[model samples]
Target chain A: MKLKTLVLSPQSRLDEVCSEACRARINDYFEPVWNETGRDYTQEELSERMAEAEVIISSWGSPSLTDEMLQKAVKLRAIGHAAGTVKNLVPKQIFAQGVKVYSAAPRIALSVGEYCLAALLTSLRYLPEFDSAMREGKWKIAGLKGRELTGSTVGIISASSTARAFIKLLAPFQVDVLIYDPYLSEEAAARLNAKRATLEEVMSCPIISVHAPKLPATERMLTRELLALIPDGAVFINSSRGPVVDAQAFMEELQSGRFFAALDVFDKEPLAVDHPIRTLPNVLLSPHIAGASVQGHLALMEEVVEDIIRGLREEKTMYEVNEKMWEVMA
Target chain B: MKLKTLVLSPQSRLDEVCSEACRARINDYFEPVWNETGRDYTQEELSERMAEAEVIISSWGSPSLTDEMLQKAVKLRAIGHAAGTVKNLVPKQIFAQGVKVYSAAPRIALSVGEYCLAALLTSLRYLPEFDSAMREGKWKIAGLKGRELTGSTVGIISASSTARAFIKLLAPFQVDVLIYDPYLSEEAAARLNAKRATLEEVMSCPIISVHAPKLPATERMLTRELLALIPDGAVFINSSRGPVVDAQAFMEELQSGRFFAALDVFDKEPLAVDHPIRTLPNVLLSPHIAGASVQGHLALMEEVVEDIIRGLREEKTMYEVNEKMWEVMA
Candidate 1:
């Protein structure tokens, strides 16, 4: 008999993430328990439901699995996270307990790469400025020349999955890529068709993109000195995480109007409602998106479903985030 | 001795189009005659100067080379135009006179391709919509899910030089390309890595870009029925001459908010300041500046300079327009 599976993603995303086709597939193989209430369940509620479910499909609204909660799921053998980064959702003890875990990080990374490319291209052509000027009934402003991506240098702050995907997307331009990832080897960088460089060297390029993780060692990685090294008319893009950049220092540079920036992540999202960066003519701002998309959820959830089915059949599953890799993985 | 060359472009663009380095090279190779006043020269003024010049460097501000003006330049054997499309500046009589002519058409076409790519990437991620929403202090609105360029089908309405370059730029995405061009054969389309399709079939894609010529046979190629056939949420890009699309049909479709359009040209230039298309939320408007850039002029002029030098040596110039080809060439 097929193992019973319980889905614990945010009820708001249940329909979009797991469409009717997905539900029908689950019914064809295993029974599915879908919570009717659009809320995260308490530990007690999850523990009560654990008695019937041997597998769990978790996402944003699922509570972090604790040691106590792990003991309640006596028959549970697998957990599939239907979103990027299982770091906050899965405890270290789960790996020691032999519970398999999988995440949609790879799929989500591609989406982030697409967003970063969009941001980079948009900044190069001054799309925001043109749109704003057109809306204000202004036409053909002087000094509005645009930069082309071809034959320009692009810098990647770190060797994250999104950065890798982004570099792949830029293959046609044949732009020089400088990567600043201390964890990445020179040979690996070369294999990705990029040159390994110091953070300062990377930031000095005409286009610099931040893709480092939000870790203790990476806090304020882009220092004031490094930020200032960015040449005039250069573009700085930040879509990974907030704290990696010295937000105040970056904002001051943008305010100087010597360069441009497209920021999708910030130190404080929803961006203070009236932040000075919001009014900067050279800045393109988006509320902490760049990672999620409606069509993307379909691919993400399908992968999760595949992982869950593989786990139920005791087959080896791809994308399983093991304990040894937890420290570096987001 | 080198040929005597007279630069007849508007004085406003002299320094920009021909930098000190360019002027130094011109002086080294040719007896360069530069206009002192930063203004367009009158036909009589040009006639007076043409008598002494063996070569002419003309741009936007130069009057059309009528047979009467051509007669005045008794020693002229070459004309290098530092801009796109010499059809307006160089009459058929110039070609018939066997005067070597060169244009920056290929370089300008490349810039247009870059702009088209930027527009496509920007629209895919809904950059304009996000910018407008964020400016209004609306953060993270529902139903704001963006589309990614990967795995999507892109439709090209014609196989112009800009279209060819645009297709090359899209090589990294590995998306399916559908092309519609009566002048193109299936073999030629395959060389561009695109499948040939009917115009209606192409318009039904998630992204459709127009690049047909503005000839009598091609006017209003994007009919009202074809405009209505575009898929919902699809992006329509028109960086080529705008008359190819039925203006009223396009405006109506965009006004309905069923899809998005990024238009760099209009049937009417500067688009009547109070036009309804200007205010439509789904439309991204730019003042007809996509075909050229300030930075690009350096390379363009250098090519023109090279052609003039070659022409003086009686070598076959690569960009010389011939009488047999002028009728079909833009």
Candidate 2:
């Protein structure tokens, strides 16, 4: 059967990948979203344009597939997300309409995993702040103190795809790796060059990292109790979900100047102008951006293209989402 | 004979390494240049303290050892540099006084090589700026274009110790590397896993890294002609002396937004507050800090300790600078 594809966001790389995949699969593919006149279409215009769209290729900032929007896309059969999270685009009505949902979050996780490894090592080397100090032509300390990954302990807190890829990236570094996951088995951790440990054991390591998903059980997992157990000067990192950590508890540890943290996600993003974390001397803060390097976006686009191709060639869907259980399953 | 040493800086790591080595050898090691009150000392004071000092360990910002100063250190038999660049402390007096010089710049190069590699890859992934944008709480352009080091051409200019170390660091990545050095033989480049190239071939590659030393012949080697040859969106890295790159020429190329640069050095020591390069979007500005990370400093310290150990054993020194010209090379 011929497929009709519509792109909602303007990630140029995404559009190119999806368009190529669609053209290879069918001749009736179409684009319903465009920035003509430098503005997007209104609700009515969107409805008219999406009337024949069989699949939607989406990214961040895409309009939601609400009940009304679904009504207009009567023929829509699938939604392929060319980004990490699909929490915003998949409305309650999407599953009812039997529309398949796919996400490139896993592929994105791999690319981001590499980015995280780079950031982690750079943090250990104290590159950014030093670079900043040097640019100002001021040497805060005439010299620096740093450690190498060799013989160092690095703890990965979750079995998330990105975290898994991070293991592959660290293979050549020869550092000891520990993984903490209630659901993970010792054998699985070993395959990734990691030793499965309890959360307490993981946090107590010299280089503890957070990679847990955002779930009720995982939220604030690094409480004051767990954080207190970490060794002095341990490197704490989070490239996963933000709310998974307790901000106040973390701030307490940070204020002590006992540990170093490399944070890419936080409890509240764009942390407040006067947020205490911003003032910490030893912390490395980056907005919720650990997964959004240009390489990541391009890699994610490749995944979206694969999903679209599978949708056309395979009788079974590639990234079908069960609406009733998404929050729990994801 | 009793071994004598002098510490020329107040660096703790240097002190730790030197003390450990001295303890192992039961030698008399004195720290003569520490800032007791931040005032330069009289020659008589230095002479009195360093009467039997046979070796001097040096680093950045150490007092110059002019011909006049060497007369005070009459028994000085050898000088060990615990840092890169002996240009500041290596006076005609030390060489003329028949003092053999040793340097840890080779050891320090390992860390600098690792740092510049990370920075180069970071630029390829467009990281620092992406993280900066995320800090502002806005995620724009989900990802930019990213290329891997695998199979891509990487050009290295001037085969200094850092350049050689960088080549060693890149070995596992399995990338095609090209090198241009007036002093390097074709056989040497091949042994380094790099194909020797002309200046033209080096500039044409997507990534050009500089490791040229601050010699008269290398000044402004990256002229307008060379900088302009890099393809648009290619990366340019300068971890060596800043004068090697004509700053004015680089500033002009930056305006085109075609080439991205990561500079750990600059033409001027103190970059003016409004230095155009500081504000430029295409460049990563650092205050001459590539070879000065904490690890880099520690590596130098280790090298110095190794030299002291060799001296106590009556073995050949590890980093003798003027070996060909000195009778007491060991």
Candidate 3:
């Protein structure tokens, strides 16, 4: 028997992912939104389309499948996200309905971690302005006043895939690694060559990077108080979530010249024209492109497609947030 | 016979290099400038210092030993500069005095070379602003966009010592190295994993660093026309003397986003406050501290002291700019 599935978000190579689902004997693959005009199924098109879909694969900018949509799709079995976080589209309603969901957060983990390592090194060397100065043909020697990473302390503030992968990438460097994740066991931190510390200690480190999820307990992990504990000129990276640090407080501190920063994300998307962050010389700012590299997309698609194939074969989900196990595990 | 040598530069750690010189049978080290009673020296005092003084070790910023000063000492056999270039004090008059001049350019070459390499890597990574961003408690995933050094092209504009060290450092990264020194031999380039190239091709490279000496031939080696050949977003570093680059032209190009540069030296030291270079956001202007690190000072002193020792042992100078060699070797 074939298990029907619908993909909400359309990638350029939909054929590639569809073929993988086909290999696992899931014969039906449809994008309900794409099927327009003259189609006989008019009322509740999404519901009608997904009513029989055993799995739904989603990506960035995917439409949320709401309670009304879920009500009609009584046969909805699983939701698979091929991106970093499901919080963007996967609603609380999905959990309430007992719908299973999966995410390839682990696959995209290395991309963020690799970026974090580069950001870490960049911060230690004071390179951002050095490069800009070089462009202007001014031989500024202040760039030479940077600390080597050989004996510096690096604080990793999470135990998620990004944080874990960051620790793995830093193994070759001579940094004194400290990690602060309540979920991480002492044995795990030991094996990872990182000393498990409290959030207090991590923020006080010479180099601190945040990779925690946006759970209630983790939101605002780098609050104003925590930010004050951070050392001057130390590098801080946040690839986890934007709300982890308070932006207003950050701008105040940055203006005071008490520390240095490399911000790829912000509490608000597309920081307004008057944002102080855009003008600061000490900051390395972008439009949040770190985890969206070519390599990042490649890893995500590979992992998500693999899960789609395996789920069809074994009739089980991987990286599922809405899995039944969460009910008992929670 | 003891060879009395006068130290012109006040290197407190002068003993370390002198120790080696003493071991090599160099003797009678003296410096009258170290005395506060410089109003005048009695004939007895002058004879005690100059009766057997066979060598003088000098460097940049050293006071010239004029005809009047030299007349007080008749046995001065050789003039050695434990630093780069002798134009500062060794004028036509000193050469006319038939003093065999030696410079310790090679000894400090390797150290300056290391600093240049560090600058290149730091520029490539964009670390300084990132560090500031980290301190400001800003967490952004898009703070920096980095390019790996692997397979990247780096053009060396000259075969100076630091340039050679940079080529050696590039060996590990497997970068595409190019050289454009008119005086450089194909064999020398090959040994350093560099392809001998025309000035045009060298300029075409994305990473170009100037290591030419401040000689008449190399004045403004990187003119406005040469700057045009470089691709956008390429890195330019100058650890060599600043005259090789036209600051105004390069600064203009950098402002227009046509090039990027990291200059440790400038045409004018302490770059004037009103200097347009300082106002430009793209320029990394420093106080010419690239070759002025603690290591750089130590290296300079070590070489000068070594020369003093070697002068006593009748050893060949570490860096001899033979007036005769330029025709055949330069």
Candidate 4:
């Protein structure tokens, strides 16, 4: 008999996340029950669905599997989280109960990596500046000659999954990559085709990207002194969390016009209307969208579904989140 | 003994094109004659330099080697051109005289390829649009989800050096590439890891890039019908010469907002003051800078100098342009 799988995501989100082909695959693998209601499940509804589910498929806006809900889920074997983090969605106690947890963080990491790379290339070539100049009917903008990413040095702040994905994307370009990750060993760095360096050395590169996670230890990791290390004409990109960087120092550095920056995250979302960063010509700002994309969302569902099927078949799954991984995950 | 080489380009240009290390390498290879006048050589000065030089190094603004100048250049065995095209710099008669010609067009092609890839990634991610929206202090602008280059189809119009460079740079992305070059055989397309397709089939791809040369046969190659084949939300890039595309048809297609474009070349550049393309929201315009960068310019000199030295040593040169190649080259 096929395993009983309960999908907590509403039908509208299921339509967006899973293509018809994916839904067909899901039907083939399990006796699936989807939330027909057009919105998130209520606590009573979640408990009712959890009681019969051998596996749970969760995504954004899905109700958390609280202690009371878990008590009712006697048949639960595993959870496939179609989202970046499973921290808020699944309680840690589920692991002691021998429940398997699979996350789609790697899928989101790929999207963030693509965004970081695209931002670097765009900033290095001054695409936005040139587009603005051309819009004003101005050609031959002085001092606007572009720089090639080829044969240059790229610095990455952390050896996070997102950073690894970005490094893989940069393989085609003949660039030297320097990474500063306290957790990464020399052999690991070599495997990634990067040299392990201090934070200062990495920051000094002509192209520096930050991919540090937002842990208590990492908050304000990029201090004023580190931010000041970026040289003139350098391009800085931050697709990671904002609190990991010193916001005031980053703004001051950009205001000085010493370097260019592409910021996808800010200390505050919906950045204030009077914020000075909005008026800075040397920076490219976005609405905290480096990780979310239509393709990414779809891929997340596919990954989780495939992993769920693998777990049911007693096969190795690619994205299983063990208890050890739960502590350091972003 | 070092070979006798006359640099026809001005001192200022030489300084801009060649780095100090490149100059040192050139001095090591050639008993060089520099243009200390800080300007391009006049006809009289050119004739005087040609009388004793065994090799000539030419660049932009350098005087052409006319019949009169060639007659005086009895000792000239080769010409190294530090620019994209040598057609305007060296007369065809020089080839018949057994004088080898080498150009820096391959170097320029690499730069153009880098620019094209950068532009495509920038456009696909809506980097410019997001930046603008954020600059205006707006967040959550509806319908701004990004697309990934991974697992997408890319269409290339030609198999020129620039296009080949671009195809090489796309190795990391798991994208299916299609080519519409009549000159390329199916076997050659396979070697490039791309499928050979007709113009209409190529244009049907969501990511289409035009790299056709400017030739009589290729003029207006992208007709109105072909431009209309592009699907909605597709990205179009044209980094090659502009006259090869039907400008009016392209403009109309872009005006409809069916697709986005990043145009680096124009039929009439320093594009007209009142051209409607200047204000198009779906297009990114650059000032004819797809092939020119500080690193590209410096590499041009280095490549030409290396080829000149190799030729002097009776070795195979990488950038040699023979008579047959000259006929079909852009």
Candidate 5:
């Protein structure tokens, strides 16, 4: 018997998350609702679809499943999200109804990790300076000498999924990794092949990457004092949320030219035209595209589809998230 | 008893290659000539110093040891070169005298390998485009999508020392590597964890890196047809000598917007003032500084010093270069 699954995401994003093969697998396994409709359903429309949907497939931009929605979705058994986090999309009400939830967080974490690794290695080589010099017809410039990642110490903040993935990717390089994660035990750090360090000690490394989740405790963890503690010529990277770092302090640090940074996220999206960091040569900024790789989306979709199949069979779910897990997860 | 050693290199480059500790060790192990002098001796001056010297320490800018110089260097048992290759520095006369020759080629190869890995990862992520766009205050570009190295096929042009070191570094990444070195047998390719591929098949990969030595048979191996066969959106990297690749074909490919390139060496260096490739947004150009990292020079010095100590002790030198090895080595 095939479960009736309703995909709650905007139709335009369906192909972006799920490859054609993945979509075919979902169709083959589940009696999908509205196979070809490109509709982002309104509340009234969702109410009609909820009447028959035993399982829901959600992704980025899907409307939150509230208590009232759950009351209508009496048969709703599970949600498989083809995106990193289910925090914003899956509410406590669904769990109250004894619904199961799974996400593509692990796959998204790997993609972000790959991006961070690339950013760190690129900054270490002083690639931006060389690229600009080449464009301007300058052969070489002062302070543009390349540095090798080997024999250098790398500092990682947080034991978040992305950070763990990044650490795994670094196994081949002969580098010492220092990790600053209050939630992580010393033994846990050793298991990750990283040395446990205080925030100050982590900041002192020549290469520091932040992957802490955005929360009340982690917000502003990298304060003015912490940012200033970083060594000169160190490459500071933040693919995590901006508030997790003291943005003002970071801007000041960049202005002082004491260190370099590669940032994917900022406190504000589309940072103002007059923002000083935008013009700084020591900074490498991207428009929050670290987790937006095409392959990342496809991988997430595959994970979600597999979870859906597993849910139907009542097998163990590797990426499930409950209300308790949500409280601590990024 | 300390062996008598004469330093033949220019004085200015001493600190760049040999660190203070290295110089101290050399002084303790050997009765080094003048302990500290910046003089680059002429052939007559070298011949005068060679009479008592049991070993010679050489580097860049040291004059070649000719037949007449060798006749005067009756006591010379070995020549330690603190640089990449000894071909240009060690003449046939040195070999005829049964003088052992050693070079810092292995250390130099590692540094070049590190640079190439950094270049490959940087290009894979479209980092140059992102850096330039961010500098220009553009938050998002049309085609600045990031690509993960996982599952990507990388094509290597040779089984050179640098290429072998690079293969080791890539062990952690989930990538398939293909090699097109004619000298490499199928078994040898497997040992390097790379599959053997023809030039045409190699060029078809999404990422192509050239590490082939500059030789008569290998020169211009990446021909016009081969360059055109490269898949669209692929990254073409050449940290090796430029003549190994067909320059005109590569330039034409870049102009057509079919692929991107990261080039350290060029066909005509300080590439012409009005070179079209210089200003292309898709091309990344560096002033041939891949193997010029500061640490690279230090490592080379350390290797040469160790080889000198081993040579004096009459032990087998790991870095010793024989006539047979020199012909095939880069």
Candidate 6:
């Protein structure tokens, strides 16, 4: 018999996340019941569906699985989250019930990594500056020469999945990569074709990218002193959580016009209209979109569906998130 | 005895192209005569130096080697050009006189390829749009989702050195690459991990890039109908010569908002102040700098110096341009 699967994401999101092919595969493997509502399921609605679901599929706006809900979900053997983080969707209590969990964080990391690389290349080559000048009827502005990515030193703040993905994309550039992550061993760094360095050393690189997770320990890890270490004419990119950096310090450094930066996240969402950063000439600002893409969304659904199938077949799933991993994952 | 080498480029350019280490290496290998003047040598000045030199170093702004000057250079054995396209610098007669020639076209190609990939990623992800919106204090504009490079198809207009470098940099993206080059064999396309396709078939891809050379046959190669073949929401990039495309047709296509483009070249550069292209919303304009960069300039000097050293040692040079190759080069 096919597993009784429950899809908790709203129909509108499902339209984007799950392609027609993915839905066909889901129908082939499971007796699936999807959320037909145009919005996220209410807690009462989720509680009612939990009792009958042998397998659950969740995404960005899905209601959290509480202990009360877990009590009703006795038939739930697995939960596949078609989104980056399951931290908000799956409570620790669900793990105690012996339910398997899978996440599409790795898939999201690929998009984020690609964004980071694009941001770096764009900033390093002064692409925006050139485009702006050209639009203003200028040509080859004096002293506007750009630098190449080849044979340069790149510093990564953490060896998170997104950081690893970015490093993989950088392999062809012949650049020296320095990674700063307390958890990354020398052997692990070597395997990634990078050198393990202190946070200070990483900050000193001409091109520094941050990919730290949003955790208490990582909050404001980039202090005023560390921000000061970045050299003149350097390009700083931050695609990870905004809280991982000291907002005041970063702004002060950028104000000096000694370096350039591409920032995709902020300490607060929808950066204020009159925010000082908005007027800064040395920075390129974008809404938090490093991990959001149409292709990435579909890939997330495909990954979760495949993992759910592997779970039913008693096979190894690539993205399984056990209790230990969940606690430390971003 | 060291070879007598005459540097024909202006001193200002040498300061930018040749690093201190490169100058020291040149001193060690040859009795070098520096171009002390801050301007390009006149034809008469170049002819006087030609009589005493066994090797000649040329770059942008250097006077051309006319047949009259070639007759005066009795001891000339080699010419090393620290720039792309020696077509403007060397005469065809130089090859007939048995003078070895080396050009840094490959090094410049590396920069152009990197620029193309950067342009593709920037346009695909709608980075410029997002940045603009964010600067205007907007967040998460509706229906602004981007596509990924991971699984898309990329069309290349030619298999020139710049195109090959771009294909190499795309190795990790897992995107299908279609190259439109009549001279490229299926086996050659396979080596690049790309498919050989007709011009029309290549133009139909969602992401189209042009790297065609500026030759009599290639001029206006991308006609109105060919430009119309581009699908909606596609990204078009051109880092090669602008005259290779029909400029009027390209402007009209971009005006329709059916596609986005990042153009670095124009039929006539310093694009007119009131040009309609400057006001277009769906296009990103940049001065012709795809093949120019600080690192690329130094690399050009380094490559030519290395090749010249190899020639003196009776070793095969990597970037030697023979008569047959020069006849077909850009």
| Candidate 4's DockQ | 0.82
List model 1 lDDT by residue over B280-307, tens digit each: 8888888887776666665666778888
Error in Å for residue B181 of model 3: 6.5
Query: How many clashes in each structure?
Result: 0, 6, 38, 0, 0, 0
Please give the DockQ score of every candidate, comma-separated.
0.61, 0.19, 0.09, 0.82, 0.67, 0.80
Model 5 per-residue lDDT tens digits across residues A1-330 = 888988776568786888888778878988887435476666667776786888888788777776677788878888888888787776677777888889889888888888888888778777777877777777767655777777889999988899998888888777899999887898999999999999999999999999988878988988999988999989999998998888888888899988889899888878765677888878888888888776778777779889867866888878888888887765
Q: What order do you get sorting by TM-score, best first?
A: 6, 4, 5, 1, 2, 3
lDDT (C-alpha) at residue A313 in model 2: 67
What ranking emerges by lDDT with the best candidate at the front?
6, 4, 1, 5, 2, 3
**Model 6 clash pairs?**
none
Each candidate's fnat, listed in order, reads 0.61, 0.22, 0.07, 0.80, 0.65, 0.70
The order by descending DockQ is 4, 6, 5, 1, 2, 3
Position A274, candidate 4: lDDT: 75
**Model 2 residue A57 CA deviation in Å:** 7.6
lDDT of 3 by residue, A50-84 (tens): 66766676666456666678777777766777675
- Taking all chains together, the TM-score of candidate 3 against the true structure is 0.58
Candidate 6 local lDDT, B153-245, one digit each (tens): 999999999999899889889999999999999999999999999999999999999999999999999999999999999999999999999
Tens digit of lDDT per residue, candidate 4, span B1-330? Answer: 777888877878886578788888878878888888888888788887888989888888888889878888788888988988887777778888888899999899888988888899888888888888887878867877888888899999999988998998898888999999998999999999999999999999999998998878899989999999998999999999889888898888888988999999998877998899998889988998888788988877889889977877899889999988887777
CA lDDT of each prediction against the hidden true structure? 0.82, 0.69, 0.63, 0.88, 0.81, 0.90
lDDT of 5 at A124: 77
How much is B248 displaced in model 1, in angstroms? 2.1
Per-model TM-score, in order, reads 0.93, 0.73, 0.58, 0.98, 0.96, 0.99
All models, RMSD in angstroms: 2.6, 6.5, 9.0, 1.3, 1.9, 1.1
Assess chain B of each prediction and give its TM-score. Answer: 0.93, 0.85, 0.81, 0.97, 0.94, 0.98
Which digits, one per residue and each the tens of the lDDT, describe model 5 over residues B1-330? 777988776557786788878878878888888434466777777777777888888887777777777777888888889887877777766776788899987787777777777777777777777766776778877755777778889998888888887888788777899998888899999888899998898889999889888878778988999888999988888888989988888788889988878898888887776677878878777888777777788766668888878876888787899888777665
Model 3: per-residue Cα lDDT over B1-330, one tens digit each:
445566554443343223344324333344323312433334354445654566766555456555565665577867666555665555445455656667666655654555566666545554444444444554443534545454578988987777875676455455788899887789988887788999889999989888887778888888889888989878888888788887778777878965567767788775554666656544444455444433344345456555645654678656555555322222
Instruction: Name the runs in model 4 displaced over 4 angstroms.
Output: none
Model 5: lDDT of residue B105: 79
